[model samples]
Target: MKEGIFFGEGMKFVKDDYPDIYDAVVGLNKAAYTGKVLDYKTQKLIAIGIVAATGDETATEKQMRSGMNELKITKEEIVDALRVVLLTSGMPAFTKAMKVVSKL
Candidate 1:
């Protein structure tokens, strides 16, 4: 397996066993990250919020750490983003996100 940024276990498995699909998915990820308006950090933060709102604890934690370590995103900044989740996604989602943030 190749070493790269943020390839989940499933992606790793796909890359190893199904190179064609992995290439397509990797291409899609690259395209998604190349948006003209939002910067990479903002996109990552949004991804974190989406994952958090879904109550996917593992994905939330992984994305949180990736944003912090790779993008140098501050905890305060993440909390600020979570505020949007609170308003739109409601208390449960926001609270779950908060708990994930607290761990980091």
Candidate 2:
């Protein structure tokens, strides 16, 4: 969800130390987010489910927040994605994702 950073990484370091790399990453993000077949909102929801499935709390929270803020994705929509996460990823991931959603 961050422009050029993933998880809680510092963007300034990447921007200052690896400017080209940072730009490429940002460019990748742009390409990834551009809606083609699936809309960006749906893409965002898929992203949420993915990070949630991986059980990465910080990334999951960030993606969830980004989807909600930027795309107006609802809690219900997130929960629906979490259902898929539950099926593919299991209870622990689902619980952790639910916790993140609860905090929001």
Candidate 3:
């Protein structure tokens, strides 16, 4: 991953200390994000919702930022995705994610 790309956990330490594990994870991410079916933007939208459902503020912001920066996705599109979190994950998670999204 690029130095500032907000990829999983940086993975630098893992690469240094545990090359095998790090390689496996990198392969897994590559396979998962192949984007042969759903395009990457849709995948990103789903990712945002999943992370938002967990109510992880930092992650939510990072996802939104990455989506915006990398895919040029709009806040409205992200809000649409968050609505799913609202239904499936409930008010607290939805509200928390919405708050973060709102700032962006």
**Deviating ranges (above 4 Å) for candidate 1:** 1-4
Point out the higher-scoring one by TM-score: 1 or 2: 1
Cα lDDT tens digits, model 2, 1-104, are 43444544676688789999878888888889778788888988999999999999988999998888877999999999999999999999999999999999
TM-score of each: 0.90, 0.89, 0.89
Runs off by more than 4 Å, candidate 3: 1-10
Q: Is candidate 1 or candidate 3 better by lDDT?
A: 3
In model 2, the runs with Cα more than 4 Å from the true position are 2-7
Instruction: Please write out the lDDT profile of model 3 over residues 4-56, one tens digit for every residue.
Output: 34366757788889989887877777777878999888998999999999999
Q: For model 1, how does the per-residue alpha-carbon lDDT over 3-31 read when each residue is reduced to its tens digit?
A: 25644778778878999998887777888
Q: List the residue pairs that clash in candidate 2.
A: none
- Model 3 poorest ten-residue lDDT run: 1-10
**RMSD to native for every prediction?**
2.5, 1.9, 2.3
| Candidate 3, pairs of clashing residues | none
**Model 3 TM-score on a 0 to 1 scale:** 0.89
